[model samples]
Target: MTIYLLRRLFLLGTVLLGLSIFAFSLGYLFPGDPLQNFSGLRYLDDSTREQLTLAYRLDGSYLQQYLAFIQRLWHGDWGLSLASQQPLLTEIRQVLPATLELTSYALLVSFFVGIPLGILAAIKPDGVIGKAISAIAITGYSLPIFWWGLLLIMVFAVGLGWFPSGGRLGVLYEIPPQTGFMLVDILLSDVSYRQAALQDALRHLLLPTLALATFPTTVMIRFVRDAMLDVWEQSYIKTAKAKGLSRLQVLYRHGLRNALLPVIRQIGLQFSTLITLAMLTEVIFSWPGIGRWLIDSIYQRNFPAIQAGLMIISVLVITVNMLTEILHTFFNPLARKR
Candidate 1:
């Protein structure tokens, strides 16, 4: 297992390195000068723009800039954003946790809710419950996340006034930031602040989480149902039944375990995809996260921030995939042998 982990780590490193290069090259290839976006400001002039370009090493040849960027990366300098003129890492640190929180909650919802519905659907494939589950799954799969988020806002926030419309917390609450996670930050703060912040965060989280989770939940439901059906038809399941195992025991112990392998893999892939979706959701909701920051940087042509965000996201996705591969191998010994 140690050897396997090391191999996976190496592969992950290679994938990240390749992705960083690609992302950097793509950013470099984007049209329009970063300085031009700031050109209209009276304080900025040609000399200042030249200095800024030189400082960022953008004035150099493409090969030279790429080499310098790589060198900076190796030394743990991710460069400064043209927009904020702050270190890219600093900006990312502020936003990454919010995005993670959103994605993590969404994943939890998908697994706990979707998987159970799937199991129930599979258990009574021809029943009313199964058809209802199938209909909901299809609708969820078809709904665009932005549209879902807006619809949720209209119903829950605008219409019913059950939740705040947007932002991480209510304006009345003041919670000190410890972790970037609003829920955790609130809990760690004063009691008076905690209650309102927690409530506000959860209310704000609901729509975004549901929006982020919709497609993945639907996909998981279908996959889990199919996998369970396949596993139920296997000889081991039949043996368990012939041995007079209770139906629940045969389903849960014998069937579900075997069925989960595919679901596990899908969950892993969805988790990675959630990061990207979280960005879009964050933008739509005006929530602060890496995605929001990335979009801002893109508009400002902040190369360093864009590169750093993309590199970090790419590394994270690769790591998640590697971990999933490891988990799959562990769960099915035959996978490792192959």
Candidate 2:
């Protein structure tokens, strides 16, 4: 097991190294003046241009600039934002937790709801519940995220107004940011209307979480349903049934564990999609997260922020996949035996 983990860790390092190269090259791959918007003018005086160039290391050759970037990165110095002039890491620290919080709630919604629906659907493939589950999965899989988000906004945000249209908190609660996560920050806050603040935060999260969860929940259902079917027909499942185990025991105890391997793998595979959806969802809902922050950075032509967001997002996805692989391998004894 130790050897297996060590090997996977080595592979993870190699993957991250390759990803870093790809991510770093993105700065040069796109056609843009990283310093063009520095002064927000079509043309600049030579002195201003020179200062901008030197400030951004444009005076160096591409190789030299790349080397400098690598050196800075090695020393944990993520570059300053071209737009705000703040450190990129500092901006990420402010925004990433919001994204993480949003994604966490969405995953919770998907996991809690989808797994049971999937297990039931798999157990009763020909029944009414199974058919309904299938329909939901199909509907969710077919909907475009942008359209879905808009539809949600129209229904929940505009028509009913049960949830707030956007933003992390109601302006009424002036809770100072303790953690970047609003939900956590709310709990830590000692405001007089603390309960109201907590409720408001949750209300704000509802629409966006539902919108972001739609696709992944459907995917999870399908994965679970399919995996359960495959596991149901396994010899051990039949043996457990033959032993007169209750239906629930035979299924949950003997079948669900083996069935979960693929579902666990899908959880990792789905993370990138979650990030992508979160971007669109953030835009639609005006939620403060790295996704929306990246969008704004792109609009402002903040090259450092853009590059940093990409690198951080790519590394996050890669790391999640690596961890998922480790969990998948660790859980499957047959794989460990090999």
Candidate 3:
């Protein structure tokens, strides 16, 4: 297992190296001078452009620039955002937690809700409950994320006023940021009305989380259902049943562990999609997160922020895939033997 882990780690490093190179090269080759976004200033002059270009190291060859970027990355310097003139990492730090918090909650919703529906559907594939689950999954999968978010906001926030329209928390809550995660921050803070603050945070979180979770939940349901069905047909499943094992016992004790291998792999594989969907969900719901930050950077042509966001998100996606692969191997004895 140790050797396998080491090998996977090495492979992950290689994948990240390639991803960095691709992202950097794409950013470098992006059409438009880095200073062009600043060219509209009344007092901006040629020397200023030259100075800005030099400051950004645009004066160097592409290879030289890439090497500098690699060195900076190695030293944990993510560069400065042209928009804010602050460290890109600092800006990311402020926004990343919001995305993480939202995505985590969304994943929880998907896992808890989707898995059970999937199990029921698998148990009774042609039954009314199974058909209902299938219909729900299809609808969830087919709905556009922005549309779903808007529909949710209109119904829950606009019509019923059950939740706030946007933002992470109510301004009334003055929770200090220890972890940057709003829920955790609220729980850890010494603020008065902490319970109310936490509730407000959750209320704000609910709409976006549901919208972000929709597609992933559907995907999980389908994957789980299919995996369970496949596992249920295996010879061992029949043997367990014939041995007088109860249906639930056979399903839980023998079937589920095997079924979960596919689900586990899909979770990792679908992580990037989840992140992408979260970005759209954030935009629709006006949630403050890296997705919104990246959109603003693109509009402002903040190359450093754009590059850094790409690198960070890519690394996250790659890391998730690696972890899922490891889990998949660990769970599957056949994989271990191979």
Model 3 residue 20 CA deviation (Å) reads: 2.1
* lDDT (C-alpha) at residue 43 in model 2: 52
**Model 2: how far is 256 from its true place, Å?**
1.6
Tens digit per residue, CA lDDT, model 2, 1-338: 99999998899889877777775677666556544422223456889788767755777887766666676677767867777767778889999999999998888888998899899899998899999999989999999999998998888889998888899899988889988888888888888999999999989999899999999999989889998999999898889888999999888787887887767777788887898899999999998899999999999877667778888898899899888888887888887888
Tens digits of lDDT, candidate 3, 60-108: 8877666766776777777567776777778888999998889888888
Model 3 spans > 4 angstroms off: 1-3, 32-63
lDDT of 1 at 261: 77
C-alpha-based local distance difference test score of model 1: 0.80
Clash pairs (backbone) in predicted model 2? none
TM-score of 1: 0.88
lDDT of 1 by residue, 232-281 (tens): 88998899999999999998788977888766677569988798788889
Between candidates 1 and 2, name the one with more favorable TM-score.
2
- Number of colliding residue pairs in each model: 0, 0, 0
